[model samples]
Target: MAKSEVIDVRVSRRVLWVGAEAYPLHNIARATTIRIEPDRMAAVGRFLKSLLILAILTVAAVAVIGRVDWPSGSGQDALRGVVVFAVVMVAVFAAQLLKVLMTRTYYALVIETSGTPRAVLVSTDAREVGGLVLGIMDAISNPHAEFRTQIINYNSTHIGDKINQIGGIGNVGKRVGS
Candidate 1:
């Protein structure tokens, strides 16, 4: 006896030909590539966290010292208060400086990637930075990812043709919309 085989046929929604083989467009042949390295941002986050912890510890120590009374005529109590105030001021300054540094770094990274296929690379990096800083260090790193995504999506939709006209990695044939 012989057995019969059944076959199924269906129309694909979209198709793409990379080389000689055709692939369904909806089926991702490759995962979305990430050009930005998360480790760099993670390292920055760790540094900020350590700085914050040190600041908190220093302030606590100063508070403990301020509470104790020393010899009245020695002027040690007044010196202790001044030292505490100075340490608190330094901590506040360090926090502010770190914040500014992170902000500048985020913007620099964003601007550097503009007009490239990895333009969204900046957005992803910024997103990670913002998430880590806001989540871990209580800092406002960069709240621009959503806006950046919107802009990138819009450009990829509308001005994509113009971008392709210029001819680069972001060109039509190489990119999603082209």
Candidate 2:
């Protein structure tokens, strides 16, 4: 890790018996989870849409110009082109649908293709996660930034109380996202 590289390390609260996995904050390259597939899909869709529109416009212009012999089987060629284009559009739609169905949202310590730990935690509240990650990373890298005593809760009641402390009382009894 470069000294100038900013990395945030978040601890994930896993299952009860498994314990929290945030500290010994080494090899933590990021605090936030990365999402890539949706953007990729959008880009591909944009490209295909533009290509489709261009093809249609080109065909329309050719028909209007009528420079080619219209009576000598060019109409059959145009029909063939239209049929092929429609099939391609349907194929693209089916491929996109299959990709959507196959893709699953994962929350894990992913290794980038370049072989690096991508993040320290997943599905974190960005507001709290960043500060905590920075704090811990700083403490580890610079001894003077050591963390002071802080409450660590192990039960639902204590966790709820802490959440209430942060003015999340309304979310106390509900499951996440409820």
The lDDT per prediction is: 0.38, 0.46
TM-score of each: 0.23, 0.33
Per-residue lDDT for 1-178 in model 2, tens only?
A: 1012223333333211112433444443444434323455765676578667867876786666465567778777876776677668767766775676465433323322234454433332343434455565565466445443222221121233322244554554635665
lDDT of 1 at 168: 55
Candidate 2 regions exceeding 4 Å error are 1-37, 40-48, 51-55, 61-67, 97-102, 110-178
Please provide, for model 1 over 1-178, each residue's C-alpha lDDT reduced to its tens digit, 9 standing for 90 to 100: 0121221111123432221223333342221323332354555676677667666866776666567775764456565765677677666756765664554222111111123422221232445434322321211122222111121111121243453355357543545644
